[model samples]
Each structure stands twice: as structure tokens, then as C-alpha cells.
Target: MAMIEISGLLLLLLTIFLAGGVWIAISLMACGWVAMQFVAGGIPAGAVLATTIWGNSASWTLAALPLFIWMGEILYRTKLSEEMFRGLAPWLNWLPGRLMHVNVLACGIFGSVSGSSAATCATVAKIALPELKKRGYDEKLALGSLAGAGTLGILIPPSITMVVYAVAANVSIIQIFLAGFLPGLLVMVLYSGYIIVWHMLNPDKSPPPEPAMPFRQKLKESAQLIPCMLLIALVFLSLLLGWATATECAAWGVLGSFGIAWWSGTLTKEAFWQSVMGTTRITCMIMLILAGASFMSTSMAYTGIPLALAAWVDSLHLSPYALIAALTVMYIVLGTALDGISMIVLTTAIVIPMIKSAGFDLVWFGIFLVLIVEMAEVSPPVGFNLFVLQTMSGKDSNTVALAALPFFFLLVAAVAIITIFPQIVMILPEMAFPPQ
Candidate 1:
């Protein structure tokens, strides 16, 4: 009877999601309330609901999101993207994919310092897209590459998503970072592989420069990129070596990014003001969604919906693999309607507990979850990356959407590697973590 009721409640929730005329949080709350009516006889909905909603919102770790976002905004508004590319272009500029390679690599480097994927996509695209188009590169490659590569921002260290995951699951954030490194590199290499292989197969599609620069010139040009690399290292140490909390580490990155610009004579008062304004705007948007998600998750727990669903799933006795597979599919679906951060909030809250209850390592599972969430950020039907790419380039949105398909598959494979080989995700953190 519990199984039958759980099935009925799941269907009702699905109907609310698919009903098409309401906000997701509203729908979630409505469905959750309905579940309460069916499943819980004793609790007061309003009291339980308020407590659940406000409970997680009060976590101090959430402060990192807005701070990290502000850091990325400062970088973007200060034209760090321009500096990043100008610095790296010399070394990578002669390759077949040429500037596209620099674009991807620059985003990858920026990813090390900034934890916001949309900001990485928007900031990189805003600076690089026009220049790539001018150099006669394929629009598909230009936009698709930016959108896909930007996904790395969250998977690499200084990742806001990982911090939230650590807070949510009570795991070490350092462990999350160490585990994230290999998969992040794996994704980068795969993206580079796509660029190289795609150009190799279709030379016409990815044009080369008329006169490639000499190796020495390229080497000299790359000298400019060294400062940015140093910035990445300093920020990484602050957070990873226990010198700073994620928020303080992000503060260091924000100051350092601005300091470099000022010292280099690129950061003017005008630029600084613009950076602060942009940071304020973007940070507010993120925090609002996070707050709403907190409330909605609260409602779900208060309403007894999670308990109802968990009880139903437990009775099934399904293999862990099957359960995980279903959850991934649901994430892909939710990805269409939700931004990566919001998706993580809603899904991870509901699902992570279930996976842990089923005996999966939260550490390993967190890596898998983060990578998958990154993939959703770049996917179509609501991919924030796609919109950012389109807005930056003012070109074919459809083409960018289609081009991102290959990288999406690459993400699937990466998730599979982490899923099947939990050691791949755990080894670094296990080795790097200070004895606690």
C-alpha cells in the first residue's frame, strides 16, 4: 500500500512539473504539499515547511556563492578575458583550431580561478567570440567551443558547486577539489581532442592562419600569460591548504584579479566601478535562486515528500546502478528548465541522501554529481551556456546548440569513468587531505 501511494505521489509531482503554467519551485511546493496530505497525518504543514525551507538557507557555506560570483564578475567587467586570451594566444595561436584552442584553454585557466560556469561562458564569449569570427573561424566552432569549455569552471578547483556539495553532504571541500581535478583535466583533453580531430577530419570547417607565427614569437607572447597562472596558484593554495575558507579564498581571488589589472595599468576607476556593479547584479541573481531553492527543498522535506518517495524506492529493491541511471536521466531533464546551480540544489538534496542510504560513497558520488551538473549547464533546451554564447556572438543560436552535442557525450563518458571507478575520484583527496 505504501508502494502504491508512493507511486501515486510521484506521478502527481510529475504532473505538476509537466503542467506548464507555474514556476518550478511553486510546482515543487504544490506537489510536496499534496504529498503531505497523502502521507503525513500528524505534522503541521506550515511549521514543518518553514523550518525546512529556512534550515539549509541559514548555512554559512552558501555565502561563498555570491562572493565567488562577484569575483568572476570583476574579472569579466575588468576585461580579464581580453588579458587572458592576449596572454595565451601566442602559444596556442598557431594550432589548427588556433584562437578556438586559446578560447578553450583560456576558459579552462579562468575556470581554475572562477567557479561560476555561466560567467565563464559569458565572459569568455563576450571577449573572444567577435575576435574569432573576425579571424574567419567557423561560428559553430567558436560558440560551441566556448559554451562547452565553460562547463569546466565549476568542475575545477575554486568551484562554488563543490563547496555547496561539501556543505550539503558534510564532506571535506578539499576532498571534493582533489577529486575534481582529474575529471576536469579529462574534460579539457576531450574538448581539445574534439577541436583537433574535428579540424583534421574537416579542414574546410576549421581554417588555419595564412602565416602562422614563428615558435619564438609564440613563446614570447605566452610570457604575458604567466601572471594569470600565478594568480590561479595563489588562490588554489588559500582554499586548498587550509589558509582560508572558501569565502575568504574567493575574496583573495577578487582582490588579486583587481590588483593585477591595476598594477598592469589596465584597471581604471571606471573599470573598477563597472566590475563592482556587474558583480552586484550577478551575485544577487544567484542568491535569489538559491534562496528559493532552499525554501522549496524545505517544503519538500516538511511535506514528507522525500520520505514518501524514499520509502517507495526502498521497497523496489532495484540495483544501485539502475537507480543512478534513472537519476541521471532526471538530471538531464531538469537541466533544461534549471540552471546548473539551482539543479544541484534541488536534485542533490533529494537524491544524494537516497544514494548514501543505498551505500554509495558520498565523496565519489559528489564528483559524479558535479560533473553531470556541469554537462547540464552546456546542454540545449535551456542551457545557460547556449544563451550566453548566442548573446555574445549575436549569431546562430541553433548552430551553437547543435555543436554542443558532442561535448555532452564527452561528459557522459567522463561521468561513467568516475561512476565505475570510484578510486579515480577518491584517490587525490584521500592522498592530499590533511589528517583530520
Candidate 2:
């Protein structure tokens, strides 16, 4: 069979399974089974499936996922979001956007710890929306900024999405983490810059400025943030400075999160068990997806699908930029229906080879992939962040999605900026681990 035919067949099977409401991991596994049974003769599909799952599951580096997730889960149950708002509001009121910047800053901070976009969106929005409403901020802008900035959960260091991408792409988890740092900050700047520009143009939309705070008062107000800041510093610096592996840092982050939660007096027995249960559920889901994806990748390798697809793409004689443009569009379409991790796992097997053939660095492409996935988080229908904000604000999905539209474009702008200046994604990684 032709590669295109096989590709079409697999795609059809996947669509059928998913549209039939099969779980994503099972759908992926089913697709792999069909591919191996009919497309790749004599491959011993059952043995391959068992071994592939075991190998993917037993990965030492993959251990970081659950620990980081548990860390986020622990912090999620704390009063951190309320404290964060109190601490950050005084500092941000002087900005043109005033307290609206809290959504962006708070999401970035909380995301560093949480690593889950929905959790970050939900956690920050829980505190930010009511406060923004009380302060007479524009509802659309408050919702929009929170929806947009909430994606920082995946872009910042200790991102769950980054871990899945790095493991799938067979790259350094730390390098991918480092690579994401600047791009994440770039998105924050873009979101905040948009807020500032919007406020300046429509000054009446912002509430009257609060009274100025004395420096000591400002410092005192921000004191609650020290533990969170220290936790971020410890995990990030350990990764950047080579003091620990990603998994080690995650373990330390988990310990640090427990300490912070205890200090905040929110680490009750119930909260601890809830955090553990949340981590278990999330980790099990992700690992199942990873296992299924690994098997499918192996099956595709046996059938030569990825290489053939790469060759077909190569035959198009498209420029590197053109290929990237095509991929960006493809991912955007995928984002409307799939969550971020699903988008990454389903495509990376086929996409990474094409990327390497185009002479693009995998680490850079991982960051690019993440930025595109971030855009997906705000997209309608299946956009998780949109759903999060809608639930919090008691708005319909359309209103929440419309509010997020500008940030969606900002994410597009972010993608373009990184594509044009690839150095932004590469600088930190290169600085931390220069090529020999």
C-alpha cells in the first residue's frame, strides 16, 4: 500500500474511534492495533504492545510528571491564589492596565508551580474574577486576560506539556524546560502589553487608580509571595544550574510545595488526600496516553509511515518557513478538537521526523509546538481554558471564547515572533548547555 493510503486509513480509523467517544488512549491503541494487524504484516502486535507500554511506563525521567503534578495539586488546595492576589495587586495597580495585570502575573507565578493550564486558569480565575468585578474592571478584558494568561501554566518552567513533548521527542527535559522559559515570558509580555495598550486607548474602561502605597507597605504586602517565589527559584535554578535532574527537581518541588501548604495552614488531611488522588488520576491518564502513543509510534516505524511522510513533505520542495506555516495551521485545526497533550502525542511521531528533515532543531520546535498548543487552550469547542473561564464567570462559552479571541491572536503573534527570531527559544537552552 502507498504511504498516503496507509496514512489516510490510520487517520480515518482514529477519527472514527475518537468520534465514537472512545477514550483517547484506547483510541490511539486501537489505531495502532489496526495498523499493525493489517498494514504491517508479521510484526507480533501483542508482544510489541506489552513491551512498548512497559518501556514507556518505566522511564525514570517520566517520573517527573506525577511529582510535578502532585506539587501543583498540593498548592492548588492552598490559599495561595487569594494571597497572590493580595500581594500582586498593590504592585500592579501602577501599570496602565492596573489590577488586570494580576491575571497575567498571577497565572505566570501559579503556573510555574501547577504546570497544568486548566488548574492555573481555574485557580487564578477563582480569585481574580470576583476581585476584578468588584474593582469595576471591564468584564471582557478581565476574562480575556485571565483566559489568555492562564495558558502560561504550560509555557512556564515545570510545564506538564513540556515534559510530554520532551519525552516524546527524545530530547533533554531540562533543555526543553529552559527553552520554554523565555518564550513563556515573551507571551506574558505580549499579554500585558496588549492590556496596557487597550487600557491607554480606552482609559475610561479602567477604574480610578488606588492610593499609592509606601515602599514598606508594598514590601509588606508582597511578603506572602516569598515562599512561592522561593519554590520557583529552587526548582528552576536546580534545572538551569545542573544541580539536579528534572525528576530530582520535581521531588524537591513536591517537598517544597508541602512545606508551603503547611505554612499556609491549608494542608489538612482531606486536602492532602485530595491532592494525592488528583495527582494519581492525572498521572495515570497521562501515562496511559503516553503508553498508547509509544505503541502507535512503534507501529508507524514498522510500517515506515513517518519516514514516508517526511519524504513526501520533502518532495514538495517547500521552504523551511513554508513547512512551518503549514504545520502551524495544522496544529491550530487540531487544537479546536483536541486538548494540548493529545495534540502533541498524536502528531509528534509523524511531525518530528519532518521537522528534523527540514534541519530544524528539535528543542526549538518543541517550544514552537508548545506555543501553538497554548493557542489551542483558548480556542472554542474543546478549548479547556475557555471552559474554565466560562464556568468561573457564569458566562456562555461564546462570551468566554470571544473574550479570549484577542489573546488567541496574541498567541499567533507569539508563534510568528519566535519563528522569525528563533533565538528567543534557543538562547536560554544554549546558554545553559552550550554545544560541545
Candidate 3:
């Protein structure tokens, strides 16, 4: 019995399980069971499964997942977006796209705070959509920018996706967080720059600028931005300065979110409980998937599949750039079916060996993978942000995808930039956390 034959069998079983409507986590575990039983018959399959799931599930670093999620949930229920729009509109109305820039700026800010792309898209769209429509702002630009900027939720520090990737790849979560900052900012700048350029070329696409407000008046109206800014600064600084562990920073975010909600008069007993419940559901789902992925990783190790695949890929002698290009395309295709986190967890165990063999930095690849996932968030059919914007805007998914298309390309451009100058992704992490 050859290893290839055993790998084929396990892959088939996993596919059938998935196509038959088994949950991803369950399917992964079942596949791991099948692999261990048949391919590595000498080992105790059930014992391995239990111990692997337990070990991965009990990680203290994983505690950050629920806390960050809770912070996002709490802030989601507040008037944060509404205030952001109010504060940002006056300041940005003089720009080429008028208030449409609000969508990009607000989502970037809120996404940084929330750490969930869907929440950022939904929260910003809930306020910005109707207001932009009423103000005669171009719907396409508004929708596109929102979809793109919302992805910043995962790219920014405190990102749930980054934490998952870090844990899976055995890298430093803080280093991954640091690595993402520049790429995230690059994407945001590209989105905004495209908006400005597009509006400049097609003037009528943007409404006539509102009369410029006095600088002092604009400052007064923009004061509402303070709380959101303070929260972002606190979460980022605590982690970057080594003042807190990732989990401790997440705790600080949750506490700050609660305080802000209370001051904003949006916190109720019901809202608090809702946030807690939402966090529990999301945390359980991610944890289960993590456990399954861990088991599956172990299964692949025992089967020698990952090592064999890496050796085969190495035999081809493909350059690092070529490998990254192939992966970018693969991830985009996979994005149509799997959400960002699932895509990372599903492939990392096997793909990582190949990536490391190419002499690429795992941390750099982590940032690059995240940028690809950000593109996935806005891809058609199953893009989480596309669905979110569709529900809010009452537009069909295709229409939403079309609206998001330009920003999608903008993400591709960011990927290209980072690939060409890997330092764009690595510099911040390297500078902040200099190697011993």
C-alpha cells in the first residue's frame, strides 16, 4: 500500500463527509480518524484524537479569541458607526468622493477596534448606506469601499484571523499582529486613493461638495471620534510596548468597550448578555475547528503526506515568487467556498512545509496569507462581506460583488506590492520585536 494511495483515500473520505453536509470540524476529525486507523495502523487512533483535541483546545493563548470576539460584539451594539459617520463626514466631505470616503475611513477605524470584517461591514453599512443614498453619494463607490475596508478588521492588530494563523503556524501572535499593520494600512490607502482618483475622473459620480465648515466647527463635530481612537490606541500600544499579553490586551479591549458603551448610554442588561452569548457561540465554533485541524495535522504527520508533498514540490525547483503566485490563485478559488479562517486552517498544515522549504519567512507568509484572505472576504458567491453588504443594501449578491470588484483588485495590487518588497510586511514586526 503506497502513501499516495492512502492519501487519496483519506482525501476522498474528507470530501464525501464535507459534501454530505458534515460540519467542517466534524469532517476534519473524522478524516483524521480514518487516516490514523488505516495509514498509521500501529498507533492508537482514538487516543491520539482525544489527546490532540484536548491539547489544542486547552491553549491559554486561545483565551484571546473569545475576549476579542466579545469586545467586537459589545461595540457592535453601540452607536459607534453612527457617531463615526457624523464625525468623519464633515471632515471628509471636501474630498473628491464627498461623504463616500466615510465608508472606507469609518470601516478601517471600526475594523481595527472590532477585529471582525463582517461586523465592520455590517456596522458601517447600517449607518453609511442610508445616509449616503440620501445624500446622493454613488452607491457603487460606497459599497465597494465598505467591502474592501471591512477586510481591515482581520488585517489590523487584535485580529481574530491573525491569532488563529499564529496558533496554527506556531508563530508569535504579537509578531503577526505587528507584521499586519503596514499591509493593512497599504490596503486602506489604496482603497481611498482609488476612490479619489475615480471620482476625479468621473466628477458626477460624486455629489457636489458641501460648503466647507469652519475648521473649529469641524473639530467640534469630530470630537465624537475620541472614544474610538482611545480604544484603538490602548489595545495597540499595550501589545506593542509589551505592557500586556495578547489575552490581557483583549481583556483591556473588552473592558474599554464596556466603558464606552456605558458612557454612550447603549449598554443594557440585554445587550451585555447578547454580547456574551454571541462570543460563546463564535468561540466554540473556532475552538472546535482548531481541535479538528490539530488532529488532522497530526494525521498528516503520521501519514508522511506533508513531508512527501514538500519533497515533491521541492523537486520542481519553483522559485518562491512562483509558489506564492500559485498559492494566491488557489486561495482565491478556495475563498468561494471557505471563509478566511477555515481556508488558513485547512491548508496550513500541508502547505506550510512547502513554504518553509522555499526559504520564506513564516511570519511574512502569515501576513501574505492574511492579505489573500482579505481578498476572500470580498470575493463572490460566499464572501462574508458580500453577503453582509447584500443584506444591508437590499442588493443581489452579484450586484454587491460587482460593487466590490475594484477593491478586490486593489487587494491584489497590495499582494503584488508585498510580494515584490517582502519588507513591506516584515519591517514593522522586525523593528518592533527585534530578534535576540
Candidate 4:
């Protein structure tokens, strides 16, 4: 009952702070301070806060975050998406949805290198939207597909969200990265399949199929895609093949992205400065949130809140799937208010113990967590991708949300598939880093 009251007080304070438009990181810190001083009591809150923030902020695994962000920033300024469109258009032209597949393919490819959902959505849409519209493609399908496929950024690795989960849950970032691969591909295939089915059902919505391009000509057009593909292969394979750590591969990614930008004649001084600034701003935001959440996590521990809650939850003897279903509902509600990272950081304190008690693998749960966040990315109220699409398409959030509805359900379907077949999320990691 005391724990219930403490939880209620903290939740009420957090809701008030967030609703009042406080920055999430600061709101989290304030909540942690309140918990420390009132709920936990007796600890030197200042000392614990300072040390915990510093330790988490200085994490070597986290060094990869900014580097990966910088790489995405550089590519975002380049014509990579344009090149990918040109390369992919001819190959997919005869397929049921024709060039619409480019949105999914390009997002999947870009997401591999970018590791950010918003960046992937914005970057691909910047080029694909105008081009697809020009070719008389269906606006709703293009928009929805880009929005859905963009989530590949977090699921395919070098992912910032994966890094945060790794740090919070104390798992191998590499293993998490590896685990995400097959599932990411699964989502892509599911998305593409949906597009094919949609076009088949409503053939007139898509532009009429064009004549098949000469095989050799298709190959030539695809040459425009070589540099970006090579960079992705370099970054991804290096990590997968054990040639480098996640941080080191990220560094290589940055260098390779810069080289590609320069080689493509798009790396201007202005663009360089912009990429640096973008990386700094995003990195700082994530770091502050990480620091604040660290402090809060520590405070929660000192208060015995998480352990008590876990004990209570365990006593109920809910099955593993039941616990996951409950968490899914909780996270979706939280998603309407908080972004994915904040949700992960704030809940890890309570969720981890329940997960362990249910005998689920944390790494697999990390993938599960990411897919749910991907769902949240398209969800309304605070969905980041919805906001992004609204700005680009000039549609109201509701309209954009409606267009994204199919893909949203598709993401939910992905979660269910992975839940029933956990190996889909586990196979690559086990093969890559087999149990010793």
C-alpha cells in the first residue's frame, strides 16, 4: 500500500510536469529528485545524481550514438535517396505497386545506415514524395509506406534506440544489433507484401505498369546505388563479421558517409557545419535524457520501489505472454505522451525484474520493445513520424494518421508474429554469438 501511494504520487507529479510542457529530461530529473528526497529518503541525492549521470553519460557504448547520428546527417544532406530512387525505379516498375516499392526499399537501405526513424522518414520523403507524386503514384500509399518503412532505422542496426536499450538493460549492444536484422527484414517484407496486395486489390490506384526495362539497362541505372550500398555493406558487415565493435563501426560509417558525400560532390562547407550541428543537438538531447533517467533509475532502486513492485507482480503468477501483453498496453498509453527512448528509460526499472521473473530473454525483449516503439512512432498525439509527415505533406495529423493506419496495424501484426515465434528475433544473434 505504501508502494502504491509512492507510485501514485510520483506518477501524478510526472503527469503534471509533463502536461505543463516541461522538457522530458528535466521532468524526469525533477521526478527523480522528488523520489529521492521524499520517497527514498536519507541518501545524498546530489552526490548520487551527479555520479550516476556522469557514469551513464560517459558510457563507451554511447559514443556510437553521435557518430551514427552524424553519419545519417551527412547522408541526409546528400543525394543518396535520389540516387536510390533512380536505381530502384526501373527494377520495381513492373511489380504490382511499381515504383512505390522504392519507398520501402530506400527506407530499408537508408535505415540500415541512418539508425533513426525520423531521419529515415524525412530523408526518403524529401526525395521520394515529389518524385512519386510527379509519376502519378498514389499519395496515400506512398506516404503511408514511407512512414511505416522509416521505422527500419531503429530496428536495423547502428540504432540509437537499441544502444539505449543495451545500456539500460545491460546487454550486449552487438547482440541486440544482430538480433534486430531478421525481424527488420521481416517487417520490410510484410510491408512490401501489403503494398503488393493493395495494388492488386485496387489496381487503378497505382499508375499503370510501364514496359520492363532492358536487363542490362536496369543494371546500369542501379550503378547509381553502388556507393550507398557499399557503405552500408561496410558498416553492417564489419559489425556482423566481428571486424569491429559497434562504436568503431559507427566511426567507420561516418568516414564512409563523408567520403560518399564528397565523392558525390555534395559535401559543402555549409552541409558539413549543418551535419555537425545536427549531430550535436540530437546527441545532447539524448544524453541529457539518458543522464536524467539514470538518476531516476538509481533513485527508484534506493526507494525499493522496483523490487517491491516486481515482487508483487511475481506473486500474481501471470504467464510470460500475459506480462508482455500488459506491458504492450502500458507502453502504448505512455507512447501517446512520451517518445520511445523516454518510455524505455523510465520503465526499465520496473519492467526488467518482471521480465526476468517470467524467464524471457532480455535481448529478445529489446527487439520486442523496439517494434512496439515503432508502432508508437506512427501512433497519434505524440507520434514523431506523424508529426514529420504532417509537416512534409501539409496534411493535418489526423489525416496523416489515417493514411498510416494500415501500416500501424502491420506493425502490430509484426509484434504478434515475433511474440509467437521468438526465434525470429533470436536466431541471428545466437548464430553470430553462439552460447559459449
Candidate 5:
């Protein structure tokens, strides 16, 4: 009878659904149906469910996810990533942790190109792990950096996760992308810096051997990776300069990837078709999860779940940092169960309202949320990036898990930096796309 009673019941049902099987679509549909009865006083249930799912599923921006994903797939499987790795190998080898630098750089470059963290982890793992094993670099640094570094795929542009978050949370994709650029590079740089500094401080860790490269010869060989550079330049410039929509830029990226593969002589008919198949499969999975998320969001809205929670939290007058700490922990727990995109979808709806209650910038929260979720790629017990690495390397899972620890802290540190500074995530977005 009371609004409080109805809200409490809906929360109970939500918990039960999680226990039953986190079927977001079904959970939302079922919850929305009840909320419509109790909260909205009996709105049409079937019509609402069907209409909401259809409308949310029809978004134009959401389409950019799969296209960018596809582009990354084609480029990665084509060995363009290999070219980039091969080019950087000699240059990076001279440092301590010698070949592990390859893990970081390869992950960074592929993450830039691919836009999917798992793909970046897997793609680079296929190339770098063997070399890492052969060269006697510690497996911990090798797998850990890739597992941690792979998260950059979503932080950087062509990031479907950010794009979808922008669409769902009503933020700007370009702004999110711009917001992420410096931080993403900082993550890459910091990760690489850790390896170099660690090696420098403890010569045993990085034992410097001269990379078998004459500068001129290295320069000449590296030039062969011009296609990888061009691809990176094209995606960033298009988004950065307003030369194209993120979607259009994704399209351009797909075309550019194909061109690069063609030039690299890996663009065989079989590979192209196979890439298409892989893209379709991964994209379909993403879309299915997204469809389910949209439906659940619709249902949750009907129940007033998120709004009620926001109001309740606002009553406490918690400090911004305390609220953020709570949010970070929530994401880490949920992220261990769900993938990065789902974590953003499920949490942003609830978290953004609390964030806004605290008057933190939503754009900043979006970046912060992403940084936290991306950490799952390398985290333990369900670190998807760790598994991707282990699966690729045929190494024991424990070995890969141990390898990933350093980068995990590095990512946590990055999250702390962004959380505290705010400017780290906000400055570029503000500069690129001013407020309405």
C-alpha cells in the first residue's frame, strides 16, 4: 500500500532474480511488470516490455560497438599487430624486463586499434607470450602487463563500452574518448615506466642486453609498420578533430583495417570471412547482453528502484570520496561476475544518480567507472584478461594470475589518480566538446 513497501518488495525480487540467474531481460521484464501493477497502478505490461526493448535496442550509436569490434578483429587476426610487435621488439628489448616491454607496447598498440580489451589481451598474447617464454623474462610481468594493459582497449577510442555508456548515461562519446586519452596513455606509459624503472633499479629483474638492432636497421624495419600507425592516427584524428562521428570513424576504421590487412598480404578470402564470422559472434553476444540490459533498465525505471536509492543515499550526505569508494567496490564485485560493458550498464543507471546527488561531474564518473571495470580484465578469480592470456600461452592459470598482479595495482593506482584529480579525466573532454 505504501510506496516504501512496494520499493522494498521490488528490491527483494531483484535479489531473487540475481540468485535465480542474472537474466537481466527477464529480471527487468518481471520486475517492470510488478512495478507497473504496484507503482504505476497497472500500466500495460506486455506493450511496455516489447516497446521498451525495441526502442532501446534500435540506437544508432550502439551500432558503433560491433563495427569497431569488427575492425579490430580483422586487423588483429591479420597479423598487423604482429608487424607492430616485430617492429617494436628490438627497440624495447634493450630495457630491463627486456621482452616484457613488448607485452606492454603490444597491448597498448593493439588496444588502440582493436577497441576491445579481451581481444587486445588475446591478440597480443598470441604473439608476445611465446617470445616472453623463449626470452626468459619473468612470466609475471609478461602476462600481467598484457592482462592489465588490455584494459586500454576500452579506455581508448573505438571503445564500444564507452560508446554504449555515453549513449545510455546521456554523456558524450567523443568527450568520454577525449577524457580517456591522456589517462589511457598514462596507464600505458606508467605500466611501461614501471617495467623500465623496476628493471633499472634491480638489474636482476631487467638485465639489460643490447637488442640486436643497429639504429639505422631498426629504423628501417620499424617503418614497415606504417599501416598500424596510420590506423591509430586515422581513428584518433577523426574523433579528436570532429572530422567524423564516432560511428563514421568506426566505419572508416573498419575500411582502414581492411586496407592495412590487404597491404600486409594477410587479407585472404578465408581470413576476411573468418573475421566477419568472429565479429558477428562477439557482436551478437554484446547485443544480446545490451538488449537484456535495456529491458532491465526499463523495468527498473518502472519500479523507481534507482531513483529511490539515489534519494536514500542523498539523505546520508556522504562525502564524495566515500561514495566513490563504495561505488568502486561495487563495480569490482559485480565486475568479477559480469563483463565490463554489463557492469557499466547495470551500475551507471544506479550510480549516476548518486554521483549527481553528490554534484560530481557525470563525465568524470563515467571515466572513473570505466577505469574500475577495466581492472577486471586482469583481476583474480575471474580476470577475463588473465584467462585470455593463459589460454593463449598454455601456461598454468596460476602463473598467469601471478603475472597479472603488478599491473592490477597499477590500474588501481590509476583509478585513484583519476578519482582524486578529476581533472585528469575532465580537462580533455572539456577542451574538445564544451558544455551545452
Candidate 6:
């Protein structure tokens, strides 16, 4: 059979399995089985499947996923978001957007710890929406800003999405984490900048500025944030300074999260078990998906699908920029249906080769992939962040989707900026772990 025919057959099987409501992991495994059975008839598909799943599952680096997830789960049960709001509001009052900027800053802060976009959105929105609404802030702006900023969860350090991308791309987890920092900050600045411009044009829409806060009073109000700040410093600084590996840092993060929850009096027996259970469920789902993706990737390799696809892309003779433009559109379309992690795992086997063939750095592309995933978090239909805000705001999906539209474009702009100025994504990783 021709490569195109085989690839199309595998694609059809995958689509059919997924459309039939099979679990994503099973769907992937089923597709892999069909490919190996029909296309590579001599190989023992069952043994290959077992070994591939084991190899992917037993990765020490992959240990970071659950620890980071547990940390986020524990902190989500605490009053961290409430404290963030209280601490950040006084500082952000001078900004043109006033307290609305809290959504951006708070999401960034909480996202560093949480790593999950939906969790960050839900945690921050739980505290921010009611407060913003009560303060007479415009509902649309408040909801939209939260929907937009919430995506920072995956772009910042310790991101769950970044961890998955790093493992899949066979790059340094720390390098990917470092690469994401500046781009994440860039997106935040863009979001806040848009908020400022919006407020400037429609000053009447913004609430009156709160009274200037005394420095000491501000300090006192922000004291509750010291622990969270210290935790962030502990996890990130260890990674940056080479004191701990990503997994070690994640372990430390979990310990710090427990301490914070205890100090906040939210670490009750019930909360602890709930966090553990949440961690298990999320970890299991991700691990299964990784295993299935690994098996599928192995099957594709045996059948030469990835190399064939890469050669096809090369034959098109597209410029690097044009290739990136095409990929951005492809990912955006994928985003409309699939969640971010699935997008990364499903495509990396095919996409990474194309990117490498184009001479693009995997670490830089990891950040780019993450930024695109962040956009997916806000994309309609399956956009988890949109669903999060909708549930909290008691609004329909369209309202939440509309609110997130501008930020969606802002993410696209971030993608373009990084594509043109590739240095923005590479500088930190290069500085931290320079080429020999």
C-alpha cells in the first residue's frame, strides 16, 4: 500500500474511534493496533505495545506531572486566590484597568503554581468574578479578561502542558520551562495592555479608582501573599539555579503546597483526600494518554508515516515562516475540538520532524506550541477556559466565548511576535543552558 493510503486509513480509524465516544487513550491504542496488524503484519504488535507503554510510563521526568498537579489541587482547595486578590488589588489600583488587571496578574501568579489552565481559571474566577461584579466593574470586560488571562496557566513555568510537550519533543524540561517564562510574560503584558487601551477608550465603562493605599497598609494587606511568593521562588529558583531537577522541584512544590494549605487551615483530612483523589484521576488519565500516544508513535514509525509526512511537507518547499503559518492554522483548527495535551501528543510524532527539518529548535517550538495551546484553552466549543468562566459567570457559552475573542486574537499576535522574533523564546533557555 502507498504511504498516503496507509496514513489515510489510520486517520480514518482514529476519527471513527474517537467519534464513537471511545476514551482517547483507547482510541489511540486501537488505531495503533490496526496499523500494526494490517500494515506491519510481521511485527508482534502486542509485545511492542506493552514495551512502548511501559517505557513511556516509567519515565522519571514524567513524575513531575502528578506532583505539580497535586500541588495545584491542594492549593486550589485553599484561600490562595482570595489572598491573591486582596494582595494584588491594592497594587494594581493605579493601573488604568484598576482591579480588572487582578485577573491577569492573579492568573499568572496562581498559574505558576497550578499549571492547569482550567484549574487556574476556575480558582481565580471563583474569587475574582463576584468581587469584580460587586465593585461595579463591567461584566463583559471582567469576564473576558479572566477568560484571557486564565490561559497563562499553561504558558508559565511548572506548566503541565509544558511538561507533556517537553517529554514528547525529547527536550530538556527545564529548558522548555525557562523558554516559556518570557513568552508568558509577553502574553500577560499584551493582555494587560489591551485592557488598558480598552479602558482608555471607554473610561466611562471603568469604575472609579479606589483611594490611594498607604505603603504600610499595602504591605500589611499583601502579607498573606508572602508564602505563595516564597513557594514560587522555591520551585523556579531551584530549577533556574540548577539546585534541583524538575521532578525534585515538583516534589518540593508539593511539600510547600501542603505547608501553605496547613497554614491557611484548609488542609483538613477531607481536603487532603480530595486532593489525592484528584491527583490520581488526572495523573492516570494523562499517563494513559501518553502511553497510547507512545504506542501510536511507534506504530507510525514502523510504517514510515512520520518521515513520509515530513518529506511531503519538505516537497512543498515552503519557507520557514509559511510553514509556521500553516502549522498555526492547523493547531487552531485542532484546538477547536481537542484539548491542549491531546493536541501536543497526537501531533508531535508527525509535527516535530517537520519542525526539525525546517531547522527550528524544539525548545523554542515548545513555547510556541504552548502559546498555541493557551489559545486553545480559550477557543470555542471545547475551550476549557470558556467553559470555566461560563459556569462561574452564569452566562451562556457564547457570551463567554465572545468575551474571550479579543484575548484569542492577542494570543495569535503573541504567536506572530515570537515567530518573527524567535529570540524572545530562545533567549532564556539559551542563557540558562547555553550551547557548547
Tens-place lDDT digits, model 1, residues 204-269: 876556576788876676675777788888877765567887667777777888787876677788
Which candidate leads in lDDT? 2
RMSD of 5: 2.2
- Estimated TM-score for each candidate: 0.87, 0.99, 0.97, 0.98, 0.93, 0.99
Off by over 4 Å in 2: none
Q: How far out, in Å, is residue 252 in model 4?
A: 0.7
Which parts of model 6 have CA positions greater than 4 angstroms off? none
CA lDDT of every candidate: 0.73, 0.93, 0.88, 0.89, 0.78, 0.91
- Better-scoring candidate (lDDT), 3 or 6: 6
Q: Which model is ahead, 5 or 6, in terms of lDDT?
A: 6
Model 5, C-alpha of 374: deviation from truth (Å): 1.3
The model with the greater TM-score, 3 or 6, is 6
Model 4 misses residue 329 by how many Å?
A: 1.2
Q: Point out the worst 10-residue segment of candidate 1 by lDDT.
A: 286-295
Candidate 3 lDDT over residue span 1-436, tens digit each: 7766667788788778877989999999988888888787799989999999899888889999899999999988766668877898887776778777788888888888788989989998888889888878788888888899889899987799999999999998988988888888888889889988998898867676677799999998888789989999998888778899889999999999999899989899998888889899988899889899999999999989999888888888899999999899999998988899999988999899999999999999999999999989999878999999998889998889999999999999999999999999898778878878
Superposition TM-score, candidate 1 onto the true structure: 0.87
Q: Which 10-residue window of candidate 6 scores lowest in summed lDDT?
A: 76-85
For model 2, name the residue pairs that clash.
none
What's the true lDDT of residue 393 in model 6?
86
In the order shown, the candidates' Cα RMSDs to the true structure are 3.2, 0.8, 1.3, 1.2, 2.2, 0.9
Mind giving the per-residue lDDT tens digits that candidate 2 earns over 1-47? 79999899899989999999999999999999988999888889999
In the predicted model 1, the residue pairs found to clash are 52-298, 53-298
